[model samples]
Target: MSGQGWERRHAAEYGTTAWSRAVVSCGALVAHHAGYDRRPGAVSEAAAGFRQEWMPVAELLALAACRAGQAQDRPVDDVELPVLLGWADGAHTHLLHTGPLDGHLGPAHWLRLAEDETCRSRARDVVTTESTLAIVESRELTGGRTSTPARALRLGARAAAAQARGVGFPAWADDCAWAADQVERLHLAMQAGAWRPTSAHRAYAREVHRTLVAEPDHPPCPAGAVGPSWIQRVVRIPHVRATVLALAAQPAYAVAAPASDPLGAAVDAVVHVGMEPVSVLAAGLERAWAAQLPDRPVAEWELAHIPGPVREQIRAVEALALRLTVVLLDLWHPHE
Candidate 1:
């Protein structure tokens, strides 16, 4: 499509309406934060990116959160959705509740709100206290300890309204919806210890190696020791390994991975199709980096490559990726 056509498509697909613009706008903000254009082409690119990189992780979180919320009898709200979506945005922008948001809206506030006579009465009528607490806690934790139940509840109300009007739904909303179903799978996996850190690390390493070997041009290391070295490094740094595994296990990571793999994928899917000279050039550069550390972990390779501008871009992407992962994990595994 023409640039104008793409722009119109994006606006229509993600633009605000009376009831739901906030949620859609939040989704757009996520794309924008993740280095997407918030235009039609960019949305398509993000969709592609989401499919590759983030789908699995997002599916995990969505299924887990849904079950948790349902078990607790709490209704999910726009605030929580946006926070999760933002993490999936590949930008990891901090989602704040800038509200005409009544009084103080923090975790404590959410707890109090849940206990409010009116809220309790309402929740009792529609949901169980356990469910209400679960929802409130999920919102609070997802908000990074800054959001209140009142704000979260209000946001939920807004999302409901938006859904009613059919405004700002993501083109990839189906993927997100599927993600919700996947949460139950994740819970089951967790119960079975299928998501253990050791197992996750091994899987991630294998995937990276597989991707590297499959694309011979993108060899892992100059000497082909990149994979082993990456494993060693990750194993050594318990904290980093834990973080990496945790992130790898998120639904957004899997969702965004497909969309952002090779950077150009997102660009092509969202901005324009075919091989643009700029993207081809970027891909070449990425290949060169991969070749440099044929067996190194991507995180290390990213740091080792000293192109100042590229490093900065990587930093930005990492920051967003990290934030999104944190929010998702927090929601499902709050004690952790």
Candidate 2:
């Protein structure tokens, strides 16, 4: 298909009333590092599918671009979906939310790309996959605590957002420190055999344990009673909230791994917008508990070792964060 035709079709696909909201809402949620808003029947079906199905990161960025390039009458004809200007727009919003600007890049820079036809037309001529890739690859990984690609991307997004906002870039060191402290405390508790779940945690763990034993092959149903958001509600006690926030912020836990099917690889790296951090942590906890104390009663699960998955999960989160940063900023400042 011709470029314009392809963009038109892609734009139309996500331009429907329901999908547009899904795109925008998901972008906002991911930008803020918030998880699924899991009130009963709170999220629309379309949004649920978009998040739960793990759509490609590229397509999510594309849909956001389609929204930014959309006009009152129709979507922008020259808007290159692959260019991903829409996500940049969202990032710009995220930057604004972080703090006030001191007139660095200013609103004019974004306004030109968003409103000026010439600027939008210019994007098609200048933006290409290789060109965008070069920009992403050129960014130095700085200020991230982790050494993975996702950490690089997270830092990259922060840097780019800072540059775009024309403000002093803030460090994520505090974020890293806070996450580490929380994890370490949990580790120490586990080591001493003093880390015990409260009544709420145990109750939830029992339910999760039951679910896993009953259907070892069943996938999690995000809309069900034990859905992703259910963990958030159950684990809201004072001690667990920080750990949940730290884990959830990683974003990789929100990314579903590819299935064994041939086509699953395409969507494997897709980030689930509806995924709750606590849900991922709880899932890991549930699996570990189930594996260690399969026949033992729930009362005996406290003796189980600290989950091996925590280290891996933390690593994965950093890696995915970097990948997303690159994707989101690939075609950044296209008009420039």
Candidate 3:
């Protein structure tokens, strides 16, 4: 690799443990075979995520690492071939926008894989679909920023997660984009409005729900949207401060979000928007777009949609969704 400062500092640490060494070796092998030699710390950077993997995936990593070492190969072995192709496909998309982007893999590597008759048939089926999906997703995460370390890291995560389970992002992604944007803007406004000596917290709370409340200047006509009286009953409404975090949690009280639960879509919205850790929210978002698990409970659960620890936070989000729903109802109801 490029002997970047980060690699120099952490490379020795890779030698400190079998697991760490495996990650570095594997990451480096992939980085090397894929032409990332000029890029400093590529292997070590990819290595950081190896901690949470299981043995089967680890075995694949070992194979990938070794394969990269020899012929300095393109792609990886057949154990998790689908995931590897996906990993490369997803990783390459996001890496393109990050800094020192010069030394990374690209379409050429995927093309070589297609040439292999064994993987060829399958590759032909999904390559175009996944690659196009990755491009759109990576762009959203990075946005216009040339240096989003978090978004950049997502490239590897999507790849690894794919390798582990042969899946990409969740299906309800685009549906949640507006809510995520709203929450993010609210988060910033809360931070900036903190200077009010006495009621900064209350002010923050009001600002958090101001749009829903239809406050002066932010008003959007209450008569058109659902009435907010029921939801505003909770006195201690929390800010968008994410106390509980999950990559994505299926909070549906009933399977497929029971018909009576008007806010099931809302719950799905906030959950998929990812209530905590912005990086997770931004990562795999594209995969979610490409995937569509209409009513599959196992698929939903395996997608890692719920962060079980933050039960209260999730309930809070659900309540807020109720409140927000009223706002939308009022906006659209004109006669309400």
lDDT against the true structure, per candidate, is: 0.32, 0.31, 0.32
Q: How many residue pairs clash in all the candidates, one count each? A: 54, 4, 17
**Residue-level lDDT for 311 in candidate 3:** 23
Lowest lDDT block of 10, candidate 3: 229-238
lDDT of 2 by residue, 257-336 (tens): 12431111211222232113423334434443334424543322221211112223333434433333332222121123
Candidate 1 structure quality by residue, lDDT tens digits, 124-188: 32222222433554344345454333333322332222222222433333322333334344335
For candidate 3, the per-residue lDDT at 83 reads 38
Regarding TM-score, does 2 or 3 come out ahead? 3
lDDT minimum window of 10 residues, candidate 2: 261-270
Which candidate order results from sorting by TM-score in descending order?
A: 3, 2, 1
Q: In candidate 1, residue 52 scores what lDDT?
A: 52
Compare the candidates by TM-score and give the number of the best one. 3
Q: 155-178 in candidate 3: lDDT tens per residue?
A: 233343232221122222333355
The positional error of residue 288 in candidate 2, measured at the CA in angstroms, is 32
CA deviation > 4 Å runs, candidate 3: 1-54, 62-157, 160-204, 210-273, 280-336
